[model samples]
Target: MKILILGAGQVGSSLAKYLGSDDENDITIIDKDEANLSSLQRHLDIKTVCGHASYPNILEEAGIKEMDMVIAVTKSDEGNMLACQMAHTLYQVDKKVARVRTAEYLHRKELFSDSAIPIDFIITPEGLVTDYIKRVVEEPGAEQVFEFENGLVQLVETRAYAGTPIVGHPIKELHEHLPKIHMRIVSLYRNGKAIPAYGDTVIKDGDRVYFVTKKSSVSKVLKEFRRLDKAYRNIIIAGGGHIGLNLAKHLEKNHRVRIIELDKERVIEIAE
Candidate 1:
């Protein structure tokens, strides 16, 4: 696959490092800084072009016509979207991926498809982080939560405390304790090291536990390891930015959520 990556920031460099090593991928990166390109060219097999990512001449100079996929991760949302649009419009690139963080652009997702923006994928880092934080907050005692199968199934992590019912019990006892719930103990870690998570594996106090189950049963499944965490009823979020506002809106349903923004104008705008 021939990939043309816009921007020479952390994401662009990391992508080049991973894809450049692959014998099957021919990676070309564009950036405004020659220093970033020089650093990449020194360590990777990928080609680097120096220029504004959204510029038509820059895209042409980077061989956009031959690229199988184009990835735009520039700092500016407008620049990234424009590069993807150009890649799709002029070159008819098969795949166009852009990292757009602005809340306004993401809210109107319909603009990206067809000939409008022509972006095949839109990566919203702010939205991703907000969802992750919300999951952690909603699932009491869960240190981390990840959804799978379109939110039907979830993998959760929590610590096994001494007071919990299944803390000192065998892994198999979890099923016996909650016969109706469908859950599986995926793994366990003790003293910063992985422990054998066999059926007879005993969950000890201070041990990190991982489990998988349906989203509906996640609360019940998590309680098996430890349930000492008091459910959060009141929350205060700082700032009125996209991430902060989104998180506040999601949590305000069941919890008393308040947001503090330093910008008075922004605060009034959001309040309305």
Candidate 2:
């Protein structure tokens, strides 16, 4: 696949390092900074274009027309959107992905729907990280939450707490206890190896269980199993950088977000 990535910052550089090395993929990166392009050139074999990516001519010169995928990760959402729009409408790229920061775009998710434009995916790292933090903070015991298809399907992670009803029971009893629940113990992570759960799989203390189930039945399943607990409300985040700023912006409306940073200038900026 021929992939064109805009921007050469940390995200774009790391992406080039990982995705550019794939033997089956061809990666091309574009940035306005010569220094960033030079640094990326030293480490990767992918093609680099040093120019303002927001311009259509630069994108055309970078061969966006022939690209299999176009990824716009520029700092500015306006720039990213302009580049993506050009790639989609002019170049007719197959897959287009953009990294957006503006909260308005995220809030109006219907704008990013498949039928809207040529964009295939919108990766809001800040929003994703904030959502992740909320899940973990709310369910302190849960290590992860894998939502599929806009929360239609879910894979929830929970640890076996001490004194739980299933602490001394075997995995087989779960089926008998909740016969009506449509859930599955897809796999178990023990000692770093994934083991398939069976009737004889003993539910030992401190054992981690990965449960896959429908989204609507999550609360009921947890309630029936007596594993439901209210998630924590207090959250303390340390930093006020771009990532921190984006996170706090999204969470401040609903969560008590407090940012801590060492930079005096940034501290004052945040305070203002």
Candidate 3:
């Protein structure tokens, strides 16, 4: 697959690293900074183009016409959207993904369509991060949680603590411990090394355990691995940025939330 990624900032560079590592993907990244391009070239086996990513000539230079997918992750939402529009209208690129941060543009659903902006997908980092934090908070003992199968199934990662009922016990014993609950241990990691999750394999303290279970039973499954934390009530956020504000809004309905920002103007705006 030939992928053209616009912008060489943190998200773009990180995507390049992952996509370039795959043997099948031919990745080319674009940015206005020569230094960032140079740094990326030395680290990854991918092509780099330096210019205004939204420009037609720049897209042509980056081989957008032949690209299987185009991802615009530039810092500016307008720039990203323009690049995606150009990719679709000028180059007829099939797959277009853009990172749109501002809610004003994102809230207007009519702007993103085949007849309008032509963005195939929109990636909202702030919204994704907020949802992730909400999942973590909901699952008291889980370090990471991923939902699949229309939210009916979930893959959860949590550390096996000493006080946990299942710690230092064989994997098969889970059935005996929680006879009513249904879960499966998929993998185990100890000291950054993969360990087979065999039925006879005993879970140990400090082991990073990965399991799959029904989403409705996630809380019950988690308690088997670690001590359940008390339900969160009072919360304090350090910044009133996009992520902080979104989190506060989500938690305000169920939990007491307060936000503190260094900028007085931003604080006052959030307070309102």
Top of the candidates by lDDT: 3
Better of 1 and 2 by lDDT: 1
Decoy 1 TM-score against native: 0.91
lDDT tens per residue, model 3, 1-272: 99999999999999999999999999999999999999999989999999999989988999998999999999999999999888888889999999998878978999999999999899998999988888787787888998898778989999998978888899999999889888999999999999999999999999999999998998888888889888888999888999999899888998899998999999888889
Candidate 1 deviant stretches above 4 angstroms: 260-272
178: Cα error in model 1, Å: 0.5
Tens digits of lDDT, candidate 2, 96-196: 89998777677786776445645788878877787776555544445787778886777887666556666677777777777888898776766666666
lDDT of 2 at 43: 82
**How far does residue 234 in candidate 3 sit from its true spot (Å)?**
1.1
Candidate 2 least-lDDT 10 residues: 218-227
Stretches off by above 4 angstroms in model 2 are: 109-118, 219-229, 240-272
Q: Each model's TM-score?
A: 0.91, 0.80, 0.85
lDDT of each: 0.89, 0.78, 0.92
The candidate that achieves the highest TM-score relative to the unseen native structure: 1
Model 1: per-residue Cα lDDT over 113-173, one tens digit each: 8758898888887889899999999888899999999988999999888888898889989
Clashing pairs in 1: none
